[model samples]
Target: MRLAAKANLGEGTISDFENGYRMPNPRKLAAMRRAFEGAGVVFATRGPTLTQPRWR
Candidate 1:
């Protein structure tokens, strides 16, 4: 999938993350953020909570 290609991660790894079988490290999280942001996703923070990114 695009996420896997963009993150330089295997499909299994992506699947694992999605399935909550594993958690991504800081580096992988950054890669994911970059990939999503490149696709026009913008993350927002409200107080101590994290909200979903706004799509443009």
Candidate 2:
């Protein structure tokens, strides 16, 4: 269920996204952006350094 209930998308839609069977429409993407923005989520871009940490 969408938090604002304005998206009106079902769980099946989310499932399709996770399964790579469907993609988010531009409207949905805008709604998500609005939601995240209202929630104070900051998106940033950071480049990796010459020496990156290894997971292993």
Candidate 3:
């Protein structure tokens, strides 16, 4: 699915955002994060021992 569709955003929104021509609000940001997570992406900070703790 397209990023916009996966994020439940309007068509072209993702493209615009990727092009730095648009910015998503907090809700949209969360939605985008969820979409990425659904695709098996895990967002986290790298630890000193190469371990990445979970996000929230």
Candidate 4:
């Protein structure tokens, strides 16, 4: 998701998170959610049900 300008973070920092080079702090995670929301996007996590498991 594209972060908001007011997120006050540099592009490289975000890139690192996306590339798995870094994990964002809780505050930054909240900011990212807000940023996506501002852009009319929503982020979600989904997992399979207990009755259905898939191999990775």
Q: Which candidate is the best by TM-score?
A: 1
lDDT, candidate 3, residue 15? 78
Per-model clash counts, in order, read: 0, 0, 0, 0
lDDT of 3 by residue, 1-56 (tens): 67687788987777778889989788988999887776667677862232342333
Q: Which run of 10 residues does model 3 get worst, by summed lDDT? A: 47-56
TM-score of 2: 0.48
lDDT of 2 at 29: 62
Residues 1-56 of candidate 2: C-alpha lDDT, one tens digit per residue? 25334345666765687689989888876776555544444455673232332222
Candidates in order have lDDT scores of: 0.74, 0.56, 0.73, 0.64
The root-mean-square deviation over C-alpha atoms between each candidate and the true structure, in angstroms, is 4.7, 9.3, 6.4, 9.5
Tell me each candidate's TM-score: 0.72, 0.48, 0.71, 0.62
The predicted structure with the larger lDDT, 2 or 3, is 3
Better of 1 and 3 by TM-score: 1
> Candidate 2, which segments miss by more than 4 Å at Cα?
1-8, 47-56
Q: lDDT per residue, candidate 4, 1-56, as tens digits? A: 33535466778778899899999899987887666555555454673223332212
Candidate that beats the other on TM-score, 3 or 4, i.e. the better one: 3
